[model samples]
Target: MKTTNLLMSMVIATTLFFVGCKPKDAAIQAAVQAKEATGITVAVTKGDVTLTGEVADEAAKAKAEEVAKAEKGVKTVINSLTVKPAPLPVVISEDPTLSKNVIDAVKDFPMVKATVKDGVVTLTGEIKKPALITLMQHLNALKPKKIENKLTVK
Candidate 1:
């Protein structure tokens, strides 16, 4: 009877060990699968997996989460993935490199202030002259998205 008790205890201990080990093993495996499934880089530390990288958009971020969750042993997924913003269309209007024509074009317009950032140009201020209509026509020819004309003829 003592031998049987010893055997049963050994069996129980072994089973507990296996059960404990299984989750850790599964966590590791899940991490691997998640890394493979999503091209995003994954770091697993202390049962928490952090995903990092740029994804196409919000939908892609959600898809990445789904992949991580479907894995067998992931306890928690802390997604650090960022959705890349859509690239703004390049403005050919005031490109310094494109043509000197756009440069010389704005030279005479004292009222129009042009500010360019990230390939976007913002035109602000005022203009007044019958000849200024010609100047504005030339400015519009430069191809900014839209001219914000705050000009009042004085």
Candidate 2:
């Protein structure tokens, strides 16, 4: 019984010693992912973390910093993130048929307005949140140079 107790104490002490040691990179990455900071990269060197990536928006960029800093063993957080929205496609061709087809495609959506600029299809107006995916399908079938989704969900 005495030997068993000694072994238990040793095991506990060893665990306590290493318990404070954490993988900084993995900790920061897990924290960022929990906050839905996709596309973010984390590099950790001796508890200093550097975050780099293009987030969806300014809010996402800020959240990334907050999460990285909150991670265990992170002494400092360096944020080198850029906020870049989706690129707008340049006008390739202007076709009346394209507009007509796009409009008909998303006609089920309410107050949906479609315009063709160059070869890109621009959709404006409001749609139900669920319908956005279906609308994309209909629009993609036409194969426009680019799609500008200006539609808002009601």
Candidate 3:
């Protein structure tokens, strides 16, 4: 009977050791899998994982944290993932309508010159901060192929 008790105690100790000891690499691997979506980045320090970078939205950020927490050895998760603002879609188009819109949009701003070519928009000259921001929003909606942003913001 005493032998059986000693054997049982040894088994329990072994189990506890395995359960409590978790490796850092294993946690890092789990963090990688968790941050697969978007541009989220992970850092592991002493079983505490910190997630950083910008994601598409809040849900993506939350998912990353949840994944880190679910890992075997992660004692805490510090999710600092920020949601990036949506930008205008860049569609390639050589349509002359883009030029017309750009002209009409920034006609009052004499310091700016815009040229459209092969679906790409090139802006040159100096532009005021307020107008430049507004013009960009309008230009983005036009969905040009690429923007050669040479316009100096003042």
The most accurate candidate by TM-score is 1
Write down the RMSD of candidate 2 (Cα, Å): 12.7
Model 2, range 1-154, lDDT digits (tens) per residue? 9999999999999998897565656766566556645588787777787888898888888888888787767789888999997899754434777877877887787578888877788888888877889889888878788999988888
Give the TM-scores of the predictions, in the order they appear: 0.49, 0.41, 0.43
- lDDT by residue (14-96, candidate 3, tens digit) is 99898677576655666565546757677778878888888888898888788888877778988888888999875555568
Give the winner by TM-score: 1 or 3.
1
* Per-residue lDDT of candidate 1, residues 20-139 (tens digit): 875574466566554554558777666666778889888888888777766666778888899888999865654564235545766787776666544444556666777568766886
RMSD of 1: 10.5
Task: Output the lDDT of residue 3, model 3.
Answer: 100
Candidate 3 pairs with clashing backbones: none
| Quality of model 2 by C-alpha lDDT | 0.79
* Rank ordering of all candidates by TM-score, starting from the highest: 1, 3, 2
